[model samples]
Each structure stands twice: as C-alpha cells, then as structure tokens.
Target chain A: MIELNHVTKTYPGASQPAVDSVSLTIPEGEICVFIGPSGCGKTTLMRLTNRLIPITSGSISVDGKDIMGLDPIELRRHIGYAIQQVGLFPHMTVRDNIATVPKLLGWARTKIDARVDELLTLVNLEPGTFRDRYPRQLSGGQAQRVGVARAMAADPPIMLMDEPFGAIDPINREVLQDEFLRIQDKLKKTIIFVTHDINEAIKMGQRIALLKEGRLIQTGLPDELLNRPADEFVKSFVGADRVLKRLNLLKVRDAMMTNPVHCRSEDSSEKVLEQMVKNDLAFLIVTDRDQRLLGYVNQYDLRGHKGHAGDVARKLTLTVSPERNLKEALSQMLSYDLGILVVVGEDGRIQGVLNSTTLCSLVGSTYDEHGGHWGRITAAGRIL
Target chain B: MTTYDFIVRNWPELMSLAWQHTVFVSIALAIAIATGVPLGVYLTFNRRLADTVLYLAGIMMTVPSVALFGLMIPVLSVFGHGIGTVPAVIALVLYSQLPILRSTYAAIRSVDPAIIEAGLGIGMTRAQVLFKVQIPMSLGVIFSGVRVAVVMSIGIGAIAAYIGAGGLGQYIFNGITQTYDAMINAGAVAVSAMAILADFMFGRLERTLVSKGLRRD
Candidate 1:
C-alpha cells in the first residue's frame, strides 16, 4: 500500500506550493488514478511518491515505510516508472533497454535475456522480431510498448505511470489501455496512474482522485464521482455527458435481459411467428439446438415464408460478449441500427439479450435514484 | 616535373616526411582527446565554467598556426625544449582543443533529455547515466569533432616544419626558398592526401563505434 500524509511540495523560490497538503491511501493490487487539469500538481504528486521530486513537507510511505528513509535510488528501482514521452535509449537494442535495471542489479546474463524475451511477449510484441531492434526502428505504438516493458523489467510491485498512453493516437491509445489493463489483471501490481483525460481515468482507474489547483478536491470510485459529485467544480469536470460515460463502467451482462424469447431455427415459420405474436414482439430470435444464435425472424419475413425458421431467418451479423462494457455494446447497436444484440458466452451460446429499452432503463434508473434532472429527461423520452 | 612524377622520384623522402607528419599529428590528437573530451563533459554540468573554458579554447583556435607555434617555443625554451617536436606538439594540441571540446560538449548536450530522465528514473547514478547513456549516444557527434581536429592538426603539423620540426612541411619551406616547384608540389599533395585519408578512416571508425540504432541510415 502507498500512503500520503499531508504531503506537499514547494519548488525553490516558488511563491505557492505546487502540491498542497493532501493525504490518500492506495490499497495494494489496486489502481489509483491522479487526474486534474493542466498544472494542477497531479504529476507532482506522483513524482513525490517515487521521490522524483522531493516533498517539501509532510510524508509519503510506500509499502508502509517512509520513502524519505529509503535511499532514493533503491526506492526508485523497486517502483516502475513510465512516462508519455516513452524515453527509450536509442543506442541500445530493445533487449538491452529492457535489461537495464536487471543488469544494474547484477542479474545473471541468462536470466536477463530470458526476462527480456518474456517482457516483449507480454506486451504482445513478438520477442524474436523485436528483441534486437532499436528504439529508432519502432513505431510510436511499439516504442511505447517497449517503454512499458522496460519499466516492468524488474517486476516492481508498485508502478508510477504519467500519461503512459498520452502520446499515442486515440485508436491505438485504447488498444494499449486495454492491453495494460489485461496485464494488470494478472499481475495485480499496485499502480498510481496520472492522466489529464477524465475518460481514461474512468476506464483505467479502480479509484480516481480528482485534483484542482494543486489540491485534491475529491476521491472515489468512478461511479461514486459520477453519481454523487462532491461539488459544482467536480460536477462540471465530470462533464454533462457523465450519464453516457457511466455506461463505460458497466458490463453488458449488467444491463442485458435474461431468458429472452427465442425459438429453435428448425422450427416452422408459422410456429416462430406464433411465438413472436404470443410474446407481443415483432421479432423472434432464432437459435440452433446447441443454444447458439443463428439469426432472427421478423414478422415481415415470417408471414410470407412457409419453411423452417432457419431458412427465412436473417443472418445475425452482430453479437457481443458478456464481458464487454455496455458503452461498446451501445456503440455497436447505434452504428448498426440494432434494437437488440445477442449476448454470447465463450461457448457460443446465447446467454442473454440486450435491447435499447433495458439499456436506457439501466442508466435511467441510476439517474432517478440519484434524483437528477437527467432522470426527468429520460422519463419524458419514455412518453415519446 | 609534374607533381605525380616528382612524388614518384622522391617517394622515399616523401614517405619519411609523411610518417613524421603523421606522428606529430597523432601525438597531438591523443593528448587533445584525452584532456578535451573529459573537460567538455565536465563543462556540461558546470555551465559557468564551461563558458569560460570554451571561450578560451575558441580564442586559442583563432591564433595563427605559425604564431602559436612561435609562442610555444618561447614558453617551452625555459624547460630547455625549444624549437623541436615538443613545441610543435604543444601548439598542435592547443589548436585541436576547440573542435574536440566543442563537439564533445555539444554532442553530449544534444542527447534527448527524456532518455536521460528515463535512465535516472530507472535508478542509474549520475555517473552511470553519463557513461552508459550520454557518452554512447553522443559518440557519433564526438567522432565528427575528432575528425575535424584531425584534419586541422595535419594541416597545422605541416606548418610546424617551419619551426624545425621534421615533416612534409620541410619540403615546402625548402622548395619555396630554393624555388623548386616539384618539391613544393610533392609536399602540398602529400599533406592534402593525408588529411583526406584520415577523414575517410575516421568515418569508417565512427560507423563501427556508434550503435546501428543511432545511425540515421
């Protein structure tokens, strides 16, 4: 665990302290994100944890020991540090760069080489192809991956990341974020992530600490901050579209309706149409005996057909995994003009159905419980 | 006689002078590199001191080769080593300092700050960062500086012959007084050829010394 007790930093000759007295505890195996606008001391606060910037007053303890008591070099070696610039050594090959800390600690040559290959594979870069390549040979995304690998070389229990994905293009940034999260899931390293982007904070952070003007204004889970903002500043910072943002935090399984009305594809069209009518639905999901989604049968297609439901069922081109966030499911639905998406399990079995109504109600109910103007807006939409 | 014919006829004489010239420049370069490179690196951490030292080196470079060689003789006469290889070497070493020191300082300074920060952040000591990171990264640039010093030293070493230091410059001084066009041509040609050869060899050395990753090609 990392704990801060009234930590503050005032640079030499600076009139105001860059980081004001702020105390927070980040539990082991959790990601605590430091987020704020530019020059808000979010970066400074992270630097203090690693002693990259010495604290002017107060104390920071890592793993229950006062960091000031530890040699700064020894302390830093045990903490992984990654930055937006992706500071890779140009003169060294990827293997050498990643081996830096291990070599410093005098690891056996064979062990360092093995660890280098292992790290490259972990970041999804093929070890054989990238091991001997230099940083100059890597693309921006590849370089950032190498930077991350180098930071994690020694397998430091705690990592300090300052906008690790900030330099990548939006498309690749999301990929790196997901990849990092996947690695973090298995490693469960205590991480302090710093970013200025709020959407990233919600996605990567298990808990977010909001800062403004060098002082932490509020800290809580993404849902807590979105649902119950501490004050007007936080409410505005979280933005007006926070309701939509909250969908990013929820999984498809959370909003999907289970036991959706479905019929076997081998059933007669008349039978499928009867099922749709009896359920008061215009469309019926068609599935095989294995419970795998084959397609859907609509009233228009079913009325004129006189064969097995499978023959007339329109092919289901879109399906979502239960593990994907509701935001992604929502986008797929909106982009394809889909009213409902089949939630499929790993075995290709149809586990549930997520419709626009269920998704809206899921978000709407949360807003209603919070007693906000958004709840009234969603309610009026129900009339339409 | 044509320069080529003169070179062939006095090949033995020219070869000896060329060897002497190479020796004088080589000794001077070794000393300059040893002292100048470290001083250049040290100056990076002390900007105020770097300014004063680089300025003095620059002023030394502006001194004419012959005049500087002349000054070296007087200064070294007190040590009973006037008008020979020692004074010539002292003058050449002084002349080579500016390029070697300036390039070393600039090369190290030009290294990406982010790379250095990454090194330190990863728990390297300041000295380790300099040796393992800054120095290796700056090798290409520093070599170019050494290359410049080499070409300059060769040219100036020829002038050292005027102060009685034996080299290809002797032919030029003798040929000018004797009005022997063939002798002067041989000396000038050999000196220019030597400079070009040194440059080419150093270029090859740089490619071998610097990491392939840092090479632009």
Candidate 2:
C-alpha cells in the first residue's frame, strides 16, 4: 500500500503549493486514478509518490516503509513508471528499451533477453517482429504498448502512469484502455494513474481520487463520484453527459431484457399478431429454428400478409452483441430509429433484446446504487 | 621544371614534409578533442558559463589563421618555444576549438528532455543517463564536428610552415619565395588530398559509431 499523509509540495519561489495537504491511501492490487483539470496537481501527486519532486511537508510510505527515507533511485527502480509522451529512448531498439531496468540491476544477458521477449509478448507485440525495431519505427499506439512493456519489464509491483494513453486517438485509446484493463486483471499490480479525462478514469480506474488545485475533492468508485459529485466543479468537470457516460460502463447484457417477446420464423402471422397484442408490443422479432435472429415484423408489415411472419419479415441487418456497452446499443437504436435492439450471442443466437426504456431504468438504478437522488429518476421513469 | 618533374625529383623531401604536417595536425586535433569535448559537456550544465566560453571560442574562430599564427608566435616566444612546432600547434588547437566545442554542446543539448526524464524515471543515476543515454545519442553530431575540425586542421597545418614548422606548407611558402609555381601546386595538391582522405575516413568512423536508429543515411 502507498499512503500519503497531509502531503504538500511548494516549488522554489512559488507562492502556492502545487500539491496541497492531501492525504490518501492507495491499497495494493488496486488502481487508484488521480483525475482533474490541468494544473490541478494530479501529475504532481504521482511525481511525489516516486519522489520525482520532493514534497514540502508530510510523509509518504510505500509498502509500509517511509519512502522519504528510501533512496529515490532504489525506490524508482522497483516501481514501474510510464508517461504520456512515452519517453522511449529513440536510439535503443524496442528490446533494449524494455530491458532497461533489468540491465540496470545487472541482470545477465540471457535473462534480460528472455525478459524482453516475455514483455513484448505480454504487451501483445510479436517479439520476433518488433524487438529489433527502434521507437521511431513504431506507430503511436504500438509505442505506447512498448512503453507499457518497458514499465513492466522488471515486473514492479507498483506502477505509476500519467495519461499513458492520452496522446492516442479516441478509437485506439479505447482499445488500449481495454487491453490494459485485461492485463491488470491478471497482474493485479498496485497502480496510481493520472489523467484529466473523467471518461478514461471511469473506464480504467477501480477507484478514482478527484482533485482540484491540489486538494483532494473526493475519492471513491467511479459510480460514487458520478452519482454524488463532491461539488459543482466536479459535476461540471464530469459534464452534462454524466448519465450517458455511466451507460458506457454498463454492458448490453446488464440492461438487456432476456426472454423478450420473439416469434419463430415459421410462426403464423395471425399467431404472432395475437402474441404482440397480448404483450402490448408493436413489433415481434422473427427467428429461425435455432433461435438465430432472422428479422422482425411490425404491425404495418403484417397487414394483409397471409403467410408466416418470416415471409414478410424485413431483415434486421443491424444487431448488437451482448458484450457491447449500453451506450453503443443506445446510439445504434437512435441512429437506426430502433425501438428495441436484438442482442445476439457469439454463436449468432438471439439472447435478449435492449430497449431505451430498460436502458434508462438501468442507468437510473445506478444512481440508487450509489445513494444518489433515485426518487426523481423513478418519477421521471413513470412520466416517460 | 613541370609540377610532375618537381614532385619526382623532390619526392623524399615532399614525403618528409607531408609526414611532419600530419604529425602537427594530429597532435593539435587530439589536444583539441580532449580539451573541447569536456569543456562542452561541462558547459551544457552551466548556461551562463557556456555563453561566455562559446562566445570566446567563436571570436577565436573569426581570427584569420595567419594572424592567429602570428599571435601565437609572440605568445610562445615568451615561453622560449617560439617560431617552431609549439607556436604552430597552439594556433591549430585554438582554431579547432570553436567547431569541436559548438558541435559537442549542440549535440548534447539536442537530446530529448523526455528521454532524459524517462531515464531518470526508470532509475538511472545522473551519470548513468549521461554516459549510457545522452552521450551515445549525441555521438553522431559530435563526430560530424570532429570531422570538420580535422579537415580544417589539415589545411591550417600547411600554413604553419611559415613559422618554420616543417610540413607541405614549406613547399608552397618556399616555392612562392623562389617564384616556382610547380612547387606550390605540388604542396597544394598533397594537402588537399590529405584533407579529403581524413574526411572520408572520419565519415566511415561516424557510421560505425553512431546508432543505426539515429542515422539519416
């Protein structure tokens, strides 16, 4: 565990402390994100942990030892550090870069080589293809991966990252965030991550510590901060789309209605119409014998049809998978004017259906889960 | 006599003078590199001192080679080693300083601050970062500077013959005194060949020394 007790940092000749008297504990095997706007001391806090910048007052203890007493060089070698710019040594090949810490520790050549290959593979790069290549040869995303690999080269138990994916484009950023989360699930290394992006904090951090002007505003799970922001600054910082962002963390299956009203492809049109009316539905999904979604038929499409629903069923080319986030499902529904989206499993079998109402209700309950104002949302739900 | 006939008749003397010229330039360049590189590296950490030192070196470079040589003769005369190799060498070393020093300083400064931070962040000591990271990356630029100094030194060493320091410059100065054009051409051709040869060799050395990732060609 890393604990900071009333830590403060004031640069030379500076009136205001960059990091104020902030006290926090980052439990081992958990990712604690420091998130705030520019000049909020989020980066300064991480630098303080590694003693990159000396603290003006208070104490920091890493793994139960006062870090101030420890040699900064020795402390840093044992803690992984990655940053926004990546800061890769351009003159060194990818392999040598990853082997930096190990080589610094005087690891044998063969051991360093093996560690390099293992780290490259861990970051999902083909060691054979990328090991000899320089940082300049790698793409932005690839270089970020290598930066991650280099940080983990010595398998340090605590990793400090400051917007490691901040420089990447959005699409690649999401991919890398997911990839990093997947790796973290297995490594379970204690991490202190810093970023200005709340969305990224929500997606990547298990717990977030929000700061403004060097003061710790609040520290809790992403939902806690979202549902109950400490102040107006946080609420505005999270933005007006806070509910929409909450939906991003929720999966399609979480909000999807299983055992939805669906009709077999060969079901008679009259029988489907009766089922739809009984269930107060305007349309029914038509599927094949294996429960694979073929299409759907609305009341208008069924009018004057004398055969089975499949005969008049329009192909629902747009479908969502159960693994997709609710935000993606909602956007698809909105873009396609879809009232409900058929959720397909990996095997192409219909698992459930997602409607906007159900998704909204799911998002509403999240407020309730975090002890926020759920009554207002419930009233809104009823009005909707 | 024709230039070719003069070369054949006095080939032994020409070879000896050329050897002396090589010796003078080699010693001056060696001393210049030894002194200039350290000074440059030191100055990188002290900007105020760097400005004064670099300015002095730049001013030294603007002094005409012949005039600097004349200045050195008088200065060395006080030390009782006047009008020979000592004055010539002192002039060459001073002349070579600006390029060597400037190149070293620029190369070291050109290294990315991010790379240095990464090095420090990853637990490299200051010395480790300097030797293992900064110096290696800046070597290509430093070598280019060394190449410039060497070529320039060879040309200037020929002029040192005026102060009675023996070299290919003796033929040029001697020929001018004797009003012999062939002798002057022979000396000029040999000096130019030596300079070109030094440049080519250093170019190859740079390619071998600099990391492949940093090489543009």
Highest-DockQ candidate:
1
The local distance difference test score of model 1 is 0.90
DockQ of 2: 0.68
Worst 10 residues of 1 chain B by lDDT: B65-74
Indicate the docking level reached by candidate 1. Answer: medium
Interface RMSD of predicted model 1: 0.7
Candidate 2 residue spans exceeding 4 A from truth: A257-279, A283-321, A342-353, A364-367, A370-384
The two-chain DockQ for each candidate, comma-separated, is 0.70, 0.68
- Cα lDDT tens digits for candidate 2, B115-146: 88888898999999999899989999899889
lDDT of 1 at A377: 16
Per-candidate RMSD vs. true structure? Answer: 4.6, 4.3
**Candidate 2 accuracy as lDDT:** 0.88
- Top lDDT hit: 1
